[model samples]
Target chain A: METFADSLDTPSVVVDLDLVRANIRRFQAYADANGFKVRPHIKTHKLPLIADMQIAAGAIGITCQKVSEAEAMVAGSSAITDVLITYNIVGAEKLARLAALARKVRLSVVADSADVVDGLSRTFAGEASPLRVLVECDTGANRCGVASPEDAAALARRIAVAPGLAFGGLMTYPPAGGEAAVQDFMSKAKALIEAEGLTVPVITSGGTPTMMHAAEAPVVTEYRPGTYVYNDRSLVMRGACGWDDCALTVLATVVSVPAANRAIIDAGSKALTSDLLGLTGYGHVLGRDDLAIDQLSEEHGRLVSTGPIGLKVGDRLRIVPNHACVVTNMVDEVYLIEAGQPAPRKVPVAARGRIR
Target chain B: METFADSLDTPSVVVDLDLVRANIRRFQAYADANGFKVRPHIKTHKLPLIADMQIAAGAIGITCQKVSEAEAMVAGSSAITDVLITYNIVGAEKLARLAALARKVRLSVVADSADVVDGLSRTFAGEASPLRVLVECDTGANRCGVASPEDAAALARRIAVAPGLAFGGLMTYPPAGGEAAVQDFMSKAKALIEAEGLTVPVITSGGTPTMMHAAEAPVVTEYRPGTYVYNDRSLVMRGACGWDDCALTVLATVVSVPAANRAIIDAGSKALTSDLLGLTGYGHVLGRDDLAIDQLSEEHGRLVSTGPIGLKVGDRLRIVPNHACVVTNMVDEVYLIEAGQPAPRKVPVAARGRIR
Candidate 1:
């Protein structure tokens, strides 16, 4: 069988356009059926074309992690008008950039404290439009968010009255299996914010693992799922997706087979990324599930099998990395495999490395 | 007590040129004393300016992992004329690119099998200059290279008689603390190749943890050390270098203080990378030894402490990541901290994502 790995150069990310569209539609259909607006996060593919596909498929808007990433997405695709940055925007430089980005798109950001809110207010206080700021709540993940529902309410009130800012809603990157906890925390926060006479327009939560049960959190108006567009090994292991649903795979060529059961591929941390996500191996080798990606240096990944490995130099393998989001950020561009196409189209990951 | 994080943007890699110069000189002095040439691997910093600095500091050449990276390094700096790609180059597109690169600079590559040797020969068969090919020996690293010294000599002979290939030498990415194994394998391989009447002018070995003992293998003529330019937590923990010798640090701003002992920083896997390198935490927070970077999301790092974490929102901290080489590849550019300069200079990592 002619595979994507056969034609492409080694150590390149190949996105099946067919799979991406199917994924976008599947999530959109689920959100539509469950009464939630889908704001596909560009953090997965980082390609404006993919963002355009999401928007065209009926996404409410897009989500980005950084101000520069938002700016790059906005610059690359005119279809993206609404952006919600789900991180606390800090620093005068980033706040200024956020203000500048607000002019191009309908920009909304999140904050859990007055320091982040004050910084955003300072930059946009004199702008033509008020910036929408969401109060991030800690349902359970504990990475970033307000401590309690009362704290979330307080921050919401603070954002509602802050100059050149409006209270958008509550957002949380909740635990994988904590939809009930998310609902409990967000409902209380929403009720309290409403009790204070503040309108919470949106309650957003996301994680591919808990996506199917997202309707359990009835208070959440929007769902921002990134990796669903390019489901990876972590999502697959979580039962969020299967091998057939993975849109992106790292195409790598075997470089050496020094032992009976051991071979090395050109893809490593630099190509596949080192995001283990609690898995034992780095990634799942497509069609070669018996082989374990035992070790990875910077530019080489070691594959070992229980038997003779059955591999040779120049043999290509498609790898579904443990996490798709970080792998997308490792390359400058990715190849898109399409149906009935002679060659895979090259698409630049426009927002790649926009971490600042 | 002004820190490197005080003056620059958050989530940026800051390199102290002074410390880099010291590291270069220290390693060069050791290599010079031991009668070996230093070939600095650009895989660590990926900056042409750093490559130039290494060349000026007495590096005989530069080591790159991919053909496109070598092309970018040569394009960005005129000083990098001698290039050695340590990874096996496969596929036609890359081979064509490599052949084109050899036309401009003195280029060499490594191979452990006849498939690779024949590919290199086919690419350079009619060129005016033959491509220098090295036989990679597996000195127990098990990542790549021929199985044994006999296999190394066999590949060396294959390259020596190839249409337009010159047998450069033997190369190995040896296991840490296995200098004696490297010495035994390389000496035997050298003797075997010499008995076959082929000139083996160079024998290269590298690994940051065993860098100090590289000369322990007296037959090794050149040492290719990548991480020595920017010693990281791994090196510091392994006794390869001290904390003061570290040149690169990730400057991050605390964005969320969700609990008394848990704080979150803006830098995550995207900025600092997820390379554990057998360590417990993601990185070593400068001057904050009590804190542990327990978890990393795509955009958030969770820092926890046994006691109440003193870090507040908007506070800056310098983090020495677990693996400096992978961390450097995460960002598009890094800020150079200079001694007398008023502001840190922004240097583009020209070869950051040239994985192919």
Candidate 2:
């Protein structure tokens, strides 16, 4: 029998459907047992099929980083009525797209600055359906969002007063291992918003590393964890998931055994990506912990052996990259490996390359 | 009048057609005067239109790293009869594809090990025409290829004797600033191959940083420079080309100005790529050398100001990424900016995800 693993091309992204389903069910069950609505971020897989699977597994909605990404998911699944775009949408083209997307789905966006909210207000004014806006709070992430809770409350007040824009609570993507700070910040911001006669309905806080502890934040009503659908080396290093839980991998072939203790694979920075995620090497070679992907060019991955590696040319190896989300975006299509199936199903990465 | 720059979507790969034509002509002229064949690598751009442009500008053939990439280019241009695949083609699927490609075009491949040549020989045996094989020599570049000159000659002899395989010559992707070493190695390998009653028809050696000094290596008959057509920040830092010579840039919009020194752009690692290429930042912000793209999430690029940056939300900035080739592979489509065209023409990246 020609198995799917044997027939597929080299340097391809393979997702184990069994593992993906298990991951989705595991996270959904955790959220259900607690009192949180799970809104999985589609940025990890960037596939409409995967997003649909997530929504079918009890997710309240989907979360996307870009307007085009949200549009892609919404177009794929009629069940995906609610979408939260976590990045600020700028420019006339993107704002118009956002407005159009809002007309189709229950769309809400996050903004930390007055300019972004003002732009959204102007674009959505005098529409039959008002646009929902959430104040993005920086709870120790320090990446994007308002720095202080007072700023978050002020932004909420601004959204409440802005025409054709309804204040839709607060959202925060806290730093890994900083769930307590997120709780403190969200509670303070909610209190301030309530004091200003604004109703805070949804308080979203999430990061894959701290997803299990999300219910500890009593004020958080929704959680958005993207990478839990397909764990990676970074997640494993953070003690978030076991090695067996890594569902996605880059199946690369050893193209050249140039010298002793050195081999080259077809997967390079273009496939494995250059996001170190604080790890030492590029990726983890499955079943060969002694081998290290020490260097990468655009199309060549250099694998250095820490110990004796008995790999030869044409040998295929599955590598768990440092970050799964970035790897998903690098490729156009991925194979879904179903258990006991002879051929894997190919899935198009629908929401990929949607940086706008 | 609306300019092409103003009409483009944020975080797009924009290529200046004039600069691309100038770059191709300049490199081809240099190689023509130096008595070398300019077989430009298509991995930099991966578009059939760009490959056709290179052939129109006097490129002898096209060089690709994967079989599918070569197939895409060959399918696009009938003029692209000769293609040099610089990576080892492994597995039954790829070998069959290689055989099919060989039947269509004058295909040649590089191999460093006996196993690869054996596989190719088995796959191409009994065909009407034999497949050409080149011994890949590692001349200071420790990535792939035989380590010693003797090994290169041995591989050449092996391919010469193998059924359905003809010994073409030698090929090497030398380390940057190692032109003398490549010359010495190729000369020694050529003498050994000749001593075995074999003809050294062609010797190819190239890398963008050392392309200008290619003529110093008298034994090299062909040069393959992938990044010369679209110079990037790395090429500029290495003094290979001036900043103005760069033909590609990622147009990004500032989406958030959260702090005094921090501004966030819509282009993140997905668009700009994490290829530092030994540089300090992810990319060079055009006209703003003081600002640094110090951090990158999947969808957010964090720009930190050395001093005060007067950038506001919705301001668009063109960033010259550290590595243009990787950035080209990241996006699905790129815009071609002509000097007189009001709007840049959109070109789909035909061979973007052809990793196999």
Candidate 3:
């Protein structure tokens, strides 16, 4: 029955702003200690306000996976100087958007094919400035990017000769390894590109799980790890961060006491999201390891207790989502809570649902 | 390699201006045929644009589960004259939003306890109009609402005399059963209120799954169903509607040809969403029941095939989501596709992610 005009109702996203600041500083310091440039991935926290804080705290640039996310971030923060678009810029419409962004800021994007390079070339042919391009090599992750060093070099050569494209460097997202595979992949890619008498300035490689390993990789100059700032359930399960390091949580209220051992919360898939990454359930209840959210309806979350849940009717609980990236796209706004505060400062999740 | 726009993305939330119109007409016709007033729930498609279409097709008003959704429906549609908020307005902040919305439109909400009624009374005590309230009697969903008829009547009496509140009538969301439990519960609640010399004029009950059988319930005078517009897998699996009657589908592209039998797609939880309602895998591949979306990453959908899937790289396919309501909140726009047309009109998902 408490009314804080800013305190959102049940099934709302709550962001810990103080924790986010600490996470940013920790990652930034880690990157500095290892002689790697921190291009903190903006895909984790799409809000421009948070991006401003990260950039101000000594992030070399920001990395965005979608053009819409990059567009939203730049529109909100004109102060951000460097932005590395870490996705393949395919299709004419997206290439045109990328070219326009090049005129606005120091923009760079990655591609793994010659056809994509040609598309970017034609789109930026008459633009005021050229778009920076990087050939994405597949060290592992196997989702996108070229397979071998030969393919990466071929793409780099195409970018060098394209009408309005400048070859920036080589980039690869290796799987979880102790820097050996990343260093080998980067060394081979750099050698192949330099064999064509082209200098690869920036070699980017990093994921949240292998950020520390990638930072220690001698061949990589820049790193792009997204979920490290807002550690999620997947990150905790992967031993990247502890539960206390997670900055984002879904606040839900117990709406139903179906049974003595079972209760349903108001937060469902619409709030907690349905991105379970091989995890047991949708999310983990904060401060309660004994309990698990068993099932989720569109508007109801069924939670089963191991012991006594220690929860009653109308009780509020914070849940760390399975994956924070997908959770960010499920709401319009999120409340920012300072450390050790019951009341949170209202902050608009400005780019919450920009999934284009 | 097709592109929509910066604002309008393809494979987005499409409000079939025509199908939505037809759906509204059909649901309203059903309500009229059954002698029930239609208060169409807007939670399924959280858009004021579609709410206006429902009103144009003779909806009594609109039903929203969130105050944020109600605010959007009121702001977007002038024809939505009355708004019944279906969820419990718990906190002070949401109560203020609900009371403020009451000033703009004919607002009604549900409550099951004196504490909630007292909260509403405290917010709008000196307002021009008393807050319209309905007792949410739990039929069988076991999510929220009062348990028994006596509990319903007690809350009704408290609201009838409560300051700045009016006892409207009784509302129960009967589960999947027809008249098994809901009919009896509502009848007893009506008798109790009538014995107290009070008229239970508005005995509303209905959900998408129970709407068909709801018409025959003698105690129910009105119906409120949301997902009837776009029936999902749950509805179809329940034998509610045929596959042809379902309106929504997610269009995705095969981005990776990893193996002969396995492939990856660009659309993942971030795109199609992973709201699997006890169904196997994430969603159903249209026209290919054998092909299952076995797993989903943040932006990668791992599709498993029985025999090569006969799908080539760069091929686009439509996927029927497990649940349509959660998918609506994950995008900003939707494409209204024709039966055989190459292009579709871009309809803005006006109220996407309006979760407060």
Interface RMSD, candidate 3?
3.1
- Give native contacts recovered, as a fraction, per prediction: 0.80, 0.87, 0.35
lDDT of 1 by residue, B1-356 (tens): 24455667778889999999999999999999999999999999999999999999999889999998999999999999999999888889999999999999999999988999998899899899999999988888888889888899889988989999999999988889878998899999999999988889899988778788878899899999999999999999988888888999998999999899999999999988888888898999989889999999878999999999998889998899999999889888899987887778888889988888
Identify the CAPRI category of the predicted complex in candidate 3: acceptable
Q: How do the predictions measure up, each by TM-score?
A: 0.98, 0.98, 0.86
Could you tell me the lDDT of residue B178 within candidate 1? Answer: 78
DockQ of 2: 0.80
TM-score of 1: 0.98
Q: In model 3, what is the error at residue B108, expressed in angstroms? A: 2.3
Candidate 2 docking quality: incorrect, acceptable, medium or high: high
Q: Residue A101 in candidate 3 has what lDDT?
A: 75
Chain B TM-score of model 2, please? 0.98
Writing each residue's lDDT as its tens digit, candidate 3 over B1-356 gives 12322233333554444556666677788888878888988877877767777777778898887788788778877888898887666676777788778888888988876767888888878889998899988888766678899988888999989899889898877777756687789999999998998888699887887687776687788898888887778777778777666777777666545455676665677766777766778777778877888777666677888787676555666677777787777777777655444567766676667665
What is the Cα-based lDDT of residue B60 in candidate 2? 84
lDDT of 2 by residue, A152-268 (tens): 999999999999999998999998878889889999999998998889989998889879888889799999999999999999998999889999999999988887799999999
Please identify model 1 stretches exceeding 4 Å from their true place: A1-4, B1-7
